[model samples]
Target chain A: MDTATVKKIAKYLHLAELEKREVPRITLQYPELSVEEAYEIQEHLVQIKLEHGHNIVGPKMGLTSQAKMKQMGVDEPIYGYVFDHMVKSGQEISLSDYIHPKVEAEIAFILGKDLEGTNVTIHQVLDATEYITPALEIIDSRYENFNFTLPDVIADNASSSGVLFGTLLQPPHKLELDLIGVTLLINGHTRDLGAGAAVLGHPAKSVAMLANMLGRRGLKLKAGQVILTGGITGAIQFEAKDTVSAKFAGIGSVDFVVKE
Target chain B: MHDLISEKAARFSAHLEQAELMGQGVEPLTSLDPQITIKEAYEVQLATIQKKLDTGRRVVGKKIGLTSIAMQKLLGVDQPDYGHLLDDMVVGNGETISFSRLLQPKVEGEIAFVLKRDLIGPNVSALDVILATDFVLPALEIVDSRVKDWQIKLQDTIADNASSGLFVLGGKPVKPTDIDLTQIGMVLYRNGEIMNTGVGAAALGNPAACVAWLANKLFEFGIILRAGEVILSGALSAAVNAEPGDHFSARLAHLGEVSVHFNPV
Candidate 1:
């Protein structure tokens, strides 16, 4: 991967995220962009955040399902770091923080132990988890009109922006994880519905994917971090002042008022 | 020899002693000093474990976690990881464990190897593992994270004592030869309802292979699996959530069953 390309793209995406601006897809500028290079761009972005005094809280996995993998022509999921600035848990999110904001419901895991290595499993994920919660991830892609390839999106931190956590924290043992149900509501009306299985068969596996990815990088999922598994349903675009809530069958619900 | 890594280990020891939360990720500690390598992560973990040992915690055996393909694939690894099991981490079968004592725990169903002979490695193999084992019994590892929110990586888990929390032994014990280690099956139940199921092949082909993996890994640290130690082979099924007022049980073919109750917190 070209280190200069990673720095250049990281700068573009970082500033876009800050100034709430949209830019042309990087692949258009660098058609030769590859998946590994895209992730390198993402890694640089994480460094940029850390340098700017923003902490890396945890990681989020994207494009986990086979359908998305097939759509993107990739065999695995992409990941991005969750920043402290990218959250509004149970609070109102100002639309001004983003450009053409959209939302997705996800299952998030808070690990109790460090989860990483080549041999991590969903079973081990549960063993490492502190609690499981429902999440509402607010995304505003830096790419113009959100038109980007898998690599392009990966460079943009999988379009991840803000997150709102559900208060209901359930230990993994008591819940039927595979059967966990999710309902997305917008402005007091139902918009989408899915289940934990929607996230790579089980949401825990998505987290396991993160551990493995980090493990390969010689990085482990750190303890005291939070991870938002990939979206449970397709992204739903919404406008300012829309009251949106995502309800998990057993883990409870998290809602936020989106306003400009 | 960065102060940050060693400093964090001291802080980690304080947290584990009180069953409290670890303050921050060790990434910053390593990031601050490039001299720190992957080897340092294990040292930090060992430092914390040594604190527990200094306070009178005795090592009972060890555990190999993440032995399944899905788990190995998820962590991008081709092998499992190991952690020390302490005497106090053991939970008596059919006993009610206080939920408050644990910092967000999940229970995994696995086979525990009660060894009758010391097995040292670097040269350890599955055949050696089976030969040294005295009996195999069903057990549940109550894995907990003192690191707040459990946002850990392999380094973090390794340093955090393999995330070993509490464990339980079952009513039945079977010899390693009594059952085909790879062919044995298990059913996990939560509140009298079946939740998940799996076969021993999930533990890296054969559950004994996990024991071998552990022994070999420990050899890097000049450790050996001694007689009378009980090693927890990786989970036969995915770990399940544990909550107060819940009765959970797991039964392994030929190995009988183990049960635990989480008292309301």
Candidate 2:
């Protein structure tokens, strides 16, 4: 696709999102474009948001799990865009604005320094992190006629939608590093549980990996920035009137009720 | 290029029809043209979606598929794939979803993350993942394929973005450092029966690691993890077949529980 065409598509995407109206039967017109190229346009569209004064937050990595890779039959991970508008407090999510919004439990890190380069290490992440917190991510896709492949989704910004954050917890540098547990509940019923080791052997290791990757790109984990560790538990579905909550063994709990 | 894509889509669609007529389980779709690599197919698909955008439908979010090792093996690949998630694809958490539009839909449990700042790649780590994240939430991925019976292969899926169909997210957020993500447990219940069980560790030996891996990988493509972007780490358990009128629920030991009801076609 030409740059002009890509930008045109991006503009249309922004228009659709801004209007919150569904476009009718788009597949017939773009039957020849491939999924990767679609993302290139989508990326351009997201960049437009940044150009338009919406702050570009951070990035989200999709297909991080091997299981997901096996299921989808791909070899690499996909990525997406994030913006300031999507951030929400643990208690601030309004059920009305979202369609099929779901949440997952995670650990978040706050950076104290810039981190970039391709050869960074876990220790570097540890040194760069200023604090840690419990969090939940709200994901909602905007595809009207939902159906896509890995490439198709990557172009869509890894299905990034919204996020909810919990209170700040003890810094990673001061914790015992073990014995931390997580519990998830729905409608006041205990549904799932797990320990901290479920994330890449240790959650900190994920930081190390991220640092290394960032280093390669002439980027660094900047001070005051945040990173969301992968889920503490698998995803759970939600229904209207159902209250969802996640509680850490030492940290506090976060909850939201479904609406509409 | 148009002719190539049209031809491929048509051929794959026909094979799927044949497979159904024979009552065979849908197998992976292969590129009859050996010259067409998965990467190339992905480019074509991207072009297709872009063309649509030129006309109308806007971009919404991205979807991560094939997050499990089993899926990788089944699809004859070693990594996960992704797909586009449109705004229209999203439904209320409790809303009933009709299976009529899906070729073969399945559900999986995952942990999703929201970014707080820009995360460019090269050497992103688990700790860095925490520092850059805004919050986390519980999620249920509804995977469907346009291909018949969801039988497309890895390359085909790569082109299709991993057969991501719909997603439902619970409304709540938590930080990455506050929870012990690795220790979290997950139970998948279908029709009130225990269908599957998993731990956060199942995702690349740890869910946080999965995010770290993704951060580093994105660096190769000159992409970065942006703040406010919601990222699904991948499925903790196997993708269970979802039928209409069937109810599915996944409960995280420490996070929370989520459920969805599917309506018949």
Candidate 3:
């Protein structure tokens, strides 16, 4: 695709988000835009935000689930950005700024050592040791009436909306993770069950992959940053006026209520 | 005479305010056609969102959808999909969502990452992921779509913000080497009863691999994952439906837990 066309598309998307309204569809009028073209537009969009006082925070990985790939009919994963404006403490959430949103259960970690650009092993992730916590993420979209495609969503930042962090816990070294269990409750009902192993068989490995992924981009995982390991239990759909909570066996739990 | 002009202006102002309010409150629109090629529609949809970012809207983070193996097969694909997040979509945990704007909204349990350094793409290794990250936390991702009943193709989901909605973050931060993530177990409790159970392996055989995949892919585009960014890897299990007054929770063995609640609209 032409650079001008890419910019035009980027410009339209920016307008639609600002209006909080959807724009009429535009025909690409060409085959798929080259990856470079797509990213060029993305870079311009990033700059536009910086000009508006929005700060860049970090990068997020998408499609970490092999199962999700099989469902999406793709073999590879995609990614997007996380800005300063979207992050929030678990206890301080406002109700008026979001559309429909849901939460997930996950294991979170902080990087204690610098993971430079290179192949990272699980052992290294463990050697960098710090502490661990639980977390919840809230997602909302900007599409008019909230409609979009996979590519559209990717370009839009993987629908990352809000996040919540939980208490920290560090188990004794050499402890077996299979002995741990998490209980998820929705509206006073048990909705799902899972363990840390559900995330690609191990959450640290997930961290390891993140380290290596960043390395290729000439980046490194710094100390004191947090990373969510992915869902351990299944997801539950939510509506206005609902209360949800998750409890980790022998650890802690996090909960919140939805308001109109 | 003077009063007449003032009255006319007042009426115009009222009308404009009403129009804007009405427009702002309208439900999200969805195509009536089921046969629309999701892939084609996604390309167009992405272009439009990019336009929004180009103008002023900010890029918040990324979201992963359908991390479950069942979902992958349901869409007749072999891998997970992704989408973007804007500054405006985030909300606190336990916040009510406007159903009117979403076709079908669901929830998932996931792990989220916050990076402390810049991460570029092109063959990023798992070690790089460890180095780039600052903290890892538990999260709940709300998957909502404008497509009726969450009906969509893989491409459709990719465009629709990866069915991204809202997320809640809680818990303490730990270093990657602090625990054995592969053997991590999770149990979900809704209200007071058990609902679901899973492990981290469900996320692309290992959530780390997912990170590796994302890094290599981004490298192809010359884009980099900067420090202090948050990434929601993907769902670890199936999606659970939620309604008002419902409470959900997920607990990870050794890591801790997270939860959210819905209230009456």
Candidate 4:
């Protein structure tokens, strides 16, 4: 697609999310869209949000797990801009603000030093990450009926609507990056389970992928940005009054409530 | 109702196994239909595998698809899906495959596992897979899409038997103890030109881990990995398009090289 079309679709998607409504997938019109084209649309959406006074808080990695990646035939992780309004912690989310909302438990990484350049290794990511905490990603897909392609998801900011992180923080050296486990509970019932290895083999890898992926476009993850590795356990649908808590084995628990 | 989904799923399964084209690639089945849940997608997959079993096709092993990050992006699939590799899907190395039999064919390199004992698990670990006592061989998976233009969703591909076409296995077998599977590297050459390069880390950190994942995933359907199976543990890199007269070769560090040729349809 062209720049004009990309910007138009991005703006339309941004507005659709704000309006708390659904729209037809863009792939219906651009079936031949490339990954680069989709990423361009996403970057443009971030720029539009920035211009509208939404700060670029950080990036969120989606489709990082090999199981999920292989499940979709996509080869790599895709990143979307996380705006200031999207970040939250132990706060209630009104269902009116989203469409078809789902939730996944995950790990959050806060960068201590700027990570720049391509081919950033896991070790570099570990050294750069200051703290690791439990997190929950509230995904409200903007596409109708939760039906979308990778391109459609990318254009919609990886379906990210809200984020919640626990207050407990552990230094990188004090914990096993790949060994952290989480249990997602809905209304006191265990809904899912996952390990840090679920995110592209390790949570640190997500950070490294974020840096390298951004570095390709002459961008870098600055110090003190929060990046949520893709969902660890599978995503589950949540309605009003549903309470969700992700109990991270070594870290702590992050919880939130769905409200009308 | 569940009956409606099962009906459509059974129809799609028969069409795939019989090499029948359900429709052209213009509209994806997932996009066209709405009743199919992600859970039903797996049901469709199992239904397809059961159909193969009824047709006298022995299950040789399993295959894990979309192992590499670069591969998932290339195929536009976001997660891993799997398929059963019957005794028939295995082609010997240097074999000249007739192109007319395949639909929208492509090729990629992989590691093949030959097992020694039956393994079943809901919580199988990578160590369990390693201790199963098996030899590893180099392979080239010939992937074809029945869905036109390969416009597939995760469910669509799963229901389509993980987009399985065929795989060629070669090279001397090396015991699992001989090398660190994660560090094993490979270079795929198409028509004697380098096409892609990757390592075993692409397959969920190690190819054996793919088996562990497959076993654990299959447990959900009450299936088991029997002894004496040959599994293709997913591609090492992005797949290269295949054409008539194309020669594809993959060389692995410790496993040697595997090659497959294409004949005119």
Model 4: CA > 4 A from native: B1-265
Model 1 scores a C-alpha lDDT of 0.79
Top candidate (lDDT): 4
**Candidate 4: residue A91 Cα off by (Å):** 3.4
DockQ of each: 0.01, 0.07, 0.15, 0.02
Candidate 1 regions exceeding 4 Å error are B1-265
Please give the lDDT score for candidate 3. Answer: 0.60
- Who is ahead in TM-score, 1 or 2? 1
Q: Rate the local accuracy (lDDT) of all candidates.
A: 0.79, 0.65, 0.60, 0.80
lDDT of 1 by residue, B56-111 (tens): 98988898877876766665667777788888888899999987677778888888
The fnat scores of all predictions, in order, read 0.00, 0.15, 0.41, 0.00
Candidate with the larger DockQ of 3 and 4: 3
Determine which window of 10 residues in candidate 1 chain B has minimal summed lDDT: B23-32
* Per-residue alpha-carbon lDDT of candidate 2 for residues A75-145, written as tens digits (9 for 90 to 100): 55455656788787546456667545556776777787877777667778778878877777665554565
Task: Point out the worst 10-residue segment of candidate 3 chain A by lDDT.
Answer: A22-31
Second chain TM-score for model 4: 0.91
Per-residue lDDT, model 1, residue A74, is 85
Order the numbered candidates by DockQ, best leading.
3, 2, 4, 1
Candidate 4: C-alpha RMSD to true structure equals 13.1
lDDT tens digits, residue span A1-260, model 3: 66676667777766655554544433233336444454455556666667778765544445555555556565544445556676675544555546545566766666677766679887887777576666666655555444554555555555556666667567424544433556566776656656655555566767777778667667677776666656666545566567777766445777777665
DockQ of 4: 0.02
Give the best candidate by DockQ.
3
